[model samples]
Target: MITLHHCPQTRSMRTLWLLNELGVPFQLRTYPFDRTLRSPAFLNLSPAGRVPALEIDGARMFETGAITEYLCERFSPDGLGTRPGSPNRMQWLVWVHFSETLSQHTAALTQQHVALREDHMRSPIVMKLEAARLGKCYAALEARLATPDENREYLLSSGFSAADISVGQAVYMSRHFATLDDFPATADWYARITARDSFAASLPNDDGIYDRDFYAPWPLE
Candidate 1:
């Protein structure tokens, strides 16, 4: 049986969403987003002590992107995955990995807003810059979704795939820090993809890193 070591609202949710979409049976081991991840047992599962450590086929795997590719190729090559030689394969890989680009900024903002305990510990400059960076990421998605030649309801012209699940979850985490109102196309696409039952299933039940739905930029401008 496949086992996913996850923390709610982290990159692990990406895998969880994918698994739900795949409709495959698996075990979920959840941990709080804290020092427990640094324990010796957890470190052995993920050397970096990250939330997305996956155990499959009697071996452990870390890194969200690697786990995504492996799971798609193993179980859903023609469905959630675009196999080699398929026309959409390149686009598939690009968008699938592009989630990390968006996620990196969210990670920074999460550190600034949620990780830092005291107000003085958070830097306004960092908060402003990271929020701006998320806007840039949203702009890129807006451009892609609103291409002149085609109207893409999802990231890929082919249809919904793991790419949407990956980026959509990133957007899920990002929305807490940045609103999608400015980029209409991206917002619509986000709404379309997030409406999926799979995405719904992956949502945080009770515990999460953020205490509130939205965390405004520091200093209130």
Candidate 2:
């Protein structure tokens, strides 16, 4: 059986949503977004003390992108993944991995706005810079989705794949730090992909982090 060590609203949720879409039976072990990740037992599962540790086929795995590629190749290669030599393979790989580029900025913003609980502990410059970076990522998505030839409803011309799940989940985290207002196409694409039942099922039951819907960059004081 597959076991997913997940922390809601984190990169792990990308794995969770993909698993749901795969329709494979798996056990989920939820963890708090705290120092519990650094505990000895948990560290054994994921040496880096980060979430999305997985147990499958008697082996352990971490890293959301690697896990996504592995699971899709093993379980849904023709559907959620584009196999090598396939027409959309290169683009698939690009967008799937690009999600991390977006998430890193969101992670930084989260650190500034949410993790650093006190105003004095946060840096307005970092918050603004990270949030601006997220906007740039949004622009990239907007351009991709607005491809002139195809009415690209998804990230790839082929159709929806793990790339959508990967980036969509990242955008979910990013929404707290940056609004989608400026990128109309990206906003529409985000709405379309997230309307999937699998995406809906992956939402956190209780707050995992960021108590507010939005975290504006801390204004200089």
User: Each model's C-alpha lDDT?
Assistant: 0.93, 0.92
Per residue, candidate 2 scores C-alpha lDDT tens digits across 11-130 of 999999999999999999999999999999999999999989999989999999999999999998889999999999999999999999998999998787777778889888888889
> Residue 124 in model 2: shift from native, Å?
0.6
Q: Point out where model 1 deviates above 4 Å.
A: none
Candidate 2: lDDT over CA atoms? Answer: 0.92
lDDT of 2 at 62: 98
> Which digits, one per residue and each the tens of the lDDT, describe model 1 over residues 40-113?
99999999989799999899999999999999999999999999999999999999999999999999999988
Top model number, lDDT: 1
Question: What TM-score goes with each of the models?
Answer: 0.98, 0.98
